[model samples]
Target: MVSRGYKKRGVGVMGLRHVKNPILLARAMLEHGEDDLEANPRGVNSGDLDVPSAQGHTQLYGKAAEQLAQQYELELVDPSYFFTQRRWDEHVRALEREKKGQGQATWSATEYLPQGTCGAVALDQDGVICAATSTGGLTNKLTGRIGDTPAIGSGFWAEEWAEDGDPTGSSTWDR
Candidate 1:
């Protein structure tokens, strides 16, 4: 999802869950959030097409759900307009260089990203399956980069299976 905040400053933490277990993570995230900018930057040289919504600091856990109601622009580029203008510009320039194949390339995107994450896939006594994931995402990640920790199928998934063994579990992607 193209996470964005309608204000110059907002939140950045993201969560995706198929069950209620992940709410715990959200509660914890709320406690750790800090004041940060949360605007959809414009005019940036989004050479890689990954425009970040949060600059300097990814909002701890606000403004993500708003993406659902946000109209998908045909080509949302340039992560500018953030409250920390200087930092946003520097990062965007790096992103542009990366797109031009002149910036650092030895490390994969995940290497520099925040690695601490929590995920759960559980089957309860009632045979109910649930899944959820939590992450702050890359505090300094490339714009618009979707981390596996929050992606539905790629991060965490859960499905119920029949005792007959004729059925298989599925993810949101499969559905």
Candidate 2:
């Protein structure tokens, strides 16, 4: 609930992608007290952050977050941080390049596949099945290109459907 959660009392999100990175979480910890908001994950530029072994990202963030949280300090992560003027300018430049038929795909020697979603499927006691997924974005994709993770049935889907393909169970929207 990063949209407005930091303002509330005793409210925090876990595994929720950070707006930029650990700085925000550190700020929250300082304001709300570390005990109120226990654990959270923070990172930046998730769009192109797909390495073969993701632990590298994890380890890097852990060190940064611990330092920031301990001192309630914040630091600029350069172009990676959200809303830096330099980064904004670079985004505009990239858009212009793409419009002119010039775009770079892979960032480095090792190009990872576009696999971003973390998913879970559940079957309740009543036999109702549900699926949920979350993603940061595709790796090495165009800057603003939204990945398939949120594409409903394509990315993540569940539940029974009738012969005609409509949902089998009651839905409030039909009213």
Go through the candidates in order and give each one's C-alpha lDDT: 0.40, 0.40
lDDT digits (tens) for residues 1-175 of candidate 1: 1121222121223433221223443322322333323445444674423223323433333234323112222122233422355545555665766667765533445335344466555555765555545654444566566676654345544544445432455655456
Clash counts for all predictions: 10, 0
Q: What is the lDDT of residue 45 in candidate 1?
A: 73
TM-score of each: 0.35, 0.32
Candidate 1 backbone collisions, by pair: 9-38, 10-38, 11-59, 12-59, 12-60, 13-59, 13-60, 41-80, 50-143, 52-143
Q: Highest TM-score among the candidates is held by which one? A: 1
Score candidate 1 by TM-score against the native: 0.35
Model 1 per-residue lDDT at 131: 54
lDDT of 2: 0.40
Query: After best superposition, candidate 1 residue 134: deviation in angstroms?
Result: 1.3
What's the lDDT for residue 157 in model 1?
48
